[model samples]
Target chain A: MKPSDKAPSEKALVPFVSVDHMMQLIHHIGVEEMMSGIAGYIEDDFHRWELFDKTPRVASHSEVGVIELMPTSDGEMYGFKYVNGHPKNTKEGLQTVTAFGLLANVETGYPMLLSEMTMLTALRTAATSAMVAKHLAPKGADTMAMIGNGAQSEFQTLAMKAICGLKSVRLYDIDLAATEKCAANLAAQDIKVVICKTPEEAIEGAQILTTCTADKQNATILSDNMVGSGVHINAIGGDCPGKTELAAGILQRSDIFVEYPPQTRIEGEIQQLPEDYPVTELWQVITGTAAGRTSERQITLFDSVGFAIEDFSALRYVRDQLEATGLYHALDLLADPDDPRDLFGMLQRAAPGNA
Target chain B: MKPSDKAPSEKALVPFVSVDHMMQLIHHIGVEEMMSGIAGYIEDDFHRWELFDKTPRVASHSEVGVIELMPTSDGEMYGFKYVNGHPKNTKEGLQTVTAFGLLANVETGYPMLLSEMTMLTALRTAATSAMVAKHLAPKGADTMAMIGNGAQSEFQTLAMKAICGLKSVRLYDIDLAATEKCAANLAAQDIKVVICKTPEEAIEGAQILTTCTADKQNATILSDNMVGSGVHINAIGGDCPGKTELAAGILQRSDIFVEYPPQTRIEGEIQQLPEDYPVTELWQVITGTAAGRTSERQITLFDSVGFAIEDFSALRYVRDQLEATGLYHALDLLADPDDPRDLFGMLQRAAPGNA
Candidate 1:
């Protein structure tokens, strides 16, 4: 290939960060510090939330699962993520969720970054929960109850410790092997890891309760009586229709806060409540327009269905890291002809012996 | 990176076709033959159009341009194209359009193929035009008048020759250099090329007419009086909201056929007509449910705004070609952990020394 405009040069190469590079970048920055940095970006974006073009994700549903496209543009840049959720995938030795994302420049509509977002999504989801809890959780809240010790449990536990000063996490799962796996994964962390036998015991004396079960159905991981006042509940697994983790009784007692009420109403824990139920937007709380944890007895619940802006924030954070760490390879994704109208000439020239 | 299930393995790597590889593949398969093959696939898909899940594209419009995601599924396979259009990019030595696409399995929600679609889009669009012309053009239409000699002109000319037995092409463009470039690119082909100085001379004695100008505004390259009866008009440039190439009178006088009614109504030549204006879906014509060209004196117009199914067909065809050609490499796109529940464990094991 020539160094002309038709070639895959700097103008045509899109920087791609693979799973290996993503893991190395995570280890380089340290998982906790990266999550904390992503939390900062999310908070900054939240303060300017009105400037973003917000829409509910475009979803394609099938009998087995759903594929979704989450897109947002902040006037200057555009970002989108492609993710799928097939609960039965875990049974097939596959991840229940796998994703990748792209970020593009608004002015030229040229992609700037393409990244494997499955790991990045996990980091962003946990960072978001912890970031919201930092605003809504009670003062000096240092202990979190992490129920549903699956893929997301360790990240959630660590984010709480890194972002919200969570000191200890009590883990519980119906599958004891999953709990054992999570406990083993977290054995080297600084925080205390407590293995609980039941969901009630997992929430005992913890000011923050995080539920991340992976069942694709409405299963009550937390009952109304198990949650105490002044506790912040970070619900993570109730991300799609017919899959909820908390009972309606628990939702009724907690003062709910959500990211994008329209989406959370359909896919978040708030889906169980009435359509017009009053819920404070977490952006408003972050922007100081709405109150967060007004008193010790105030029960604040961050119903996290995860939003496009949070993914956008995480993508933005990773893109910023690429230049410094050089953990990326360029993919020749775009066809760039020297003369814009001479694309056929370029193709003809590329023939064997023609060039 | 371990192969014990949480690393980039055969399950995680999506086959990628870069621009360089795409050019090599095109040369390997020959452009005209590839277009003819894609045409066959398009016809096959059109015959079963009712089985597809079709929707209008999701477009994010900016001041300078627009980026769109076009997705479709056939219950077995899912496909989507990411394309951007920036008309001003040409002046800055950039492509007006660039695209990439992906094909995924609907059952497992894992990507199977990731391809650079800028060149593929060109092939598919031309194939769709020529395939429709085969069904709608007047009998013995061996000559075509190609107006607006931009990036798509040469492909249209070649496709007509390859698919419809077109023997001659009369080319006219606002920029004379674009026409010269197209003619030079087609010199090796077994067809007669005639360069016309004006649109009137270009359409003289031509039975098929194709308009593919790239202006973003509504400028009529072909007026009503210039187009005579008994000719098929392939309109390709009127694909976005404010972009059109034909006069309203020309649309009124011809029997219009479109890919999808809802999308064509907003983005095709039919946008000039009344909201209740009657038009036929081209799939119906392809499947023998509707008439194409009933009489030699009747004028037919294929209002091809391009559809997702045509791209799906192209992607499917490419995926089928990959195994035999081996013109592809894998991108470590998906995060596949051996134990689906231990994503954190996968990450922890990916550290430099830990692995």
Candidate 2:
């Protein structure tokens, strides 16, 4: 339908999905199921990677943090996310990160969906981690160590359990309360939860080591000495410059895979390494163009600093789900005038005195 | 407060405002009055120009059109506008341009307001034109020749009358129906509407000449022969590369003014001039740091391409007005959690069988 086709009495509006609605969707579908669906979407898009128009996020940095806009499109649909990173936010009783996004139809250049992405980001990030683990982790992997239990920990644990089939999780965090809270929250789940005293203790005998520390520094949570053979590392934190989880020696010994090499080279754990260092984009593995987990004895690392395209996939998935469920609220985000040229007339029609 | 504190309960919530709400606000407050108020805000911000952190807009250009993000801040408040330009859109019954924006408190980096700017853009553009005319146009300029009557023409004409005190308007458009529609809309108002056959006839004896045509190419709407001494030219349509209104000869003869010279040099009529061509920024004129209309007989030109700060001002004004009148509905745009670390719990709370 054209923008000008609407009669004065007809109102064609955009739809908005609130955070509450998104949470309801997740709860109803189950986080595990949601992550699996999102993972499938990401994998489907990754296989057709060349169709996208990609760019490094545009960032505005300040002393305490950075705010950025990440936009990507595939000719027909355009999506963008507004996100901020402020590591000190936790100390101030705020989140270190929060985000929202919009998905628009490129044909009309009109916003079709506006969504709360903060929760979705957590879900997508965990789902992405599991997608990497599926390809990079050794077969029949069961035990996993989660270093740095924070707000994102439970989601990661559940996604791994649901998507990667992990059965046991050992948790460690510098903040004991955070780890305790995480353990308490997951107590009823089928999987085992171990509150380890130290990072070494947490990693011992684990087939997968996931590092998601919130420290805004190059703290080596996983030393080279602690990692064993045939381990898969899902490195989620150390996503900004000067923040890293693994020691340089660990990277040297592992097969490092990344999401969007250009961005990961600047923001991921590999930021500590030289630009020419070897790395592989995960899409290659998903598309079967490159080998993943070459041998059971090899260490595989997925250094993921979130990318825009994944958000695009998540937006599309959420929009589709919301439409199918008929749970979203409609919003007048774009103007749909009776006569497209007479936008001012909308004001006149809505005028209290005139009506 | 903290993003973490707000993360869990409202992890994926974003508030939205529809075009209806925007029109509601405009109708509640008379359009003439809103234009006057916006012009005041634009003038106030322009006077304190140095306080703003300004940058040239970031744009992604495709063969069909261009999409751009314009961001600016004044240490305390930050704002950005997402806009697109596709001259061919009207033929497909879509707006030539559409926009939306957000205003955030810089100290907290929390978005305070989100708005649909398609309608607001037309209002702000008109307010900006009138703001420039207030400083550069000759005193008591009653008649304005508005070339290219389209979606933007009505707002421009109304704002000129309300903010710049123009009593009569002469309308001309390539599509006679568009000009006829614009004249018909203004017939109820106090101002006299004159429909002219040609640009020359429209420009005859008019004190201010406004060129707001929708063409995306370099089409000269005004030539040196049509413009006489002392007449003020509000060049509005020629805002992108290869699009211009005044002939190079006209620009050479007039005392030109612009908004952000670096951007105007690329998008404004001055794009045709040399890199070293002398021009005064409108902010300088607003602040009284530069001369405007040096003599009643000296021609002055306000080469308006529209700018981000004006939108910032307009957003702040609309938000404040909405809040004061209780006309704005609260949006759950940001996620607010009871316990920030319990983001995963939110999903469990929303689980299938849970209330």
Candidate 3:
């Protein structure tokens, strides 16, 4: 049957989530709550990882940075993220990374949501890190050393507080002002915050260590000696070719876990290692197919380069919340003609002659 | 530098062209004029095709349909289209293909334009076909046949009339109401329209023939006997594996042209031909690197499965027009924190105590 046979009101137009609306939702729901909610979704999706059709993100690299499209589907829903990375963008008064994404119905291939994912990415990335930490970090982990404090630092602190029960954060950045800002932001919450002069100082005695520096090269933010036994290392900054945060010895010493092995092999810190080096996929641990942190003294490393599945979970979570709160503004993103075949007729009717 | 370092008003947000606004623009400009303008942009871009970084679209296929992302860039600008094809969507009262795209600056990796391309795709596909016809069709060609009169039929007719000097069209479709509706929509224009009972009757004596049927399987809409010498065929509907329009015999007899040979070889009619079947890239002919129609009696076929460059050109054209007319709404698609490094602070400031 054609669209003409359907009722006028039955025509489908996809709902969109804009950046302003996302901010409103974050404000209304509280960022801490949003991060926790997304963490739940990430955990739920990760448990069913075998249901998804996953692939490495497609990237177009240039001298300045890289632009990527990360797409995934789980038979019922489809999602993708359009993201860019330009470390130099900060110098030009732009964010180092920006992103937007879409969620669509797998059955009909119609987009259900269009959302600004720059903020969502920060939330989701932190949530994913925390989710992994919950599985791999030692029990009663109370302190996290947040190295390379920047735009993402606060979200890391919030997600850790919500998901991993982190109560205190030690912050350090090459730029002291960034660390100061991170410490001040965390102080606004109920959590305890500390400012450290160096990475070694920040990581000392911390149960969890997160390196999220924004540099575009292979800069070692953490050495093997700085990390302690049983510490869960959430490596978030080393996401592109030639950009890594950990020393090779640290990776060799830890039980490394990754999102997708093929992608992480190319983009994660493992890019520095030989192809045959062993690593466990996080989903295996989440699904109880593999072990996570076999011993309290075992150093666990989550070499995350930010996978597409996290974005999928984040988009779906945000979309559901927006629908529940009725906080999203609908965009005329798809033409809803009275007769779908009469799209041209609608244009004609709206023309000057008809008007 | 922080955003506050510059005047607050000087920070510009990216303008968004919604599908509703794009439809309104088409109405204001007249569908005929809009098609002509987009055709001009496609032609201009095709002439400089070598300047573009082109790649075959990346597709994720499911049991029901396929979702795709097509990306291309010049050194200055980059663009990509997120589109899906599910012929079964129409049965569920949804469009078979829905798309949206982004245009970004290569220098800073900043997204400059994000617009809905569901309606825009019909416009660009028609424009691209007309552009190829302008360079490849015989001189003084006017009458044309459009098989498979669906949502795309009227746009193709308008583009042909405005770009290729077609004054009359013969429409044919498996669904009779589709042809009638298409003919009625074109009644206001100067072109004469006829509803033909069969594809053979539609193509008889026509200088140009366009087949745009939407079938997910290999179904021949045009036979070798129906095609005449000197006729320029715009075959658009057969764009994926297991989907085609012209019969293999007809393809063997015509001089075929494609957008990008590497891509079309797999997705276009050439999928039926030998590995080394002779075919010309439309850009070659547009740039005078190859000859188009050698004589009035030569049968030329443009296997036009819409390319990323055409969308890129149409996106830039629409963006410029939207800016000139001030018809687009600005979307805060990207977060603009006071300091780029203080994205988390934006949330902190929005907290209850701060607010």
The C-alpha lDDT values of all candidates are 0.91, 0.83, 0.86
lDDT of 3 by residue, A1-355 (tens): 2334222233345566765677778989888898999989999999989999899998888899888889999889999999999999888788889898999888777788888888899999999999899999998999999998889999999999998899999999999999888887777689999899888889878999999998899988998788778889999999999999999999999999999999999999999999999999999999999999999999999999999999999998988886578867666666656665666766565554443
The DockQ values of the predictions, listed in order, are 0.84, 0.49, 0.60
Summarize candidate 3's per-residue lDDT along B120-222 as a digit string, tens digits. Answer: 9999999998888989999999999999998899889888888888998999999999999998888878899999999889987799999998889888899
Write the number of the candidate with greater lDDT, choosing between 1 and 2.
Answer: 1
lDDT of 2 by residue, B257-276 (tens): 99999899999999999998
Residue-by-residue lDDT tens digits, candidate 1, B67-103: 8889999999999999998999999988899899999
TM for every model, in the order presented, reads 0.98, 0.93, 0.96
Candidate 2's error at A336, in angstroms? Answer: 1.5
CA deviation > 4 Å runs, candidate 2 = A1-11, B1-17, B274-276
C-alpha RMSD over true interface residues, each candidate: 0.8, 2.2, 2.0
In candidate 3, stretches whose alpha carbon ends up further than 4 angstroms from where it belongs are: A1-12, A353-355, B1-12, B352-355
Regions of model 1 farther than 4 Å from truth? A1-7, B1-7
- What's the distance in Å from true for residue A327, model 3? 1.1
| Top candidate by TM-score | 1
Model 1, native contacts kept: 0.80
1 against 2, candidate with superior TM-score: 1
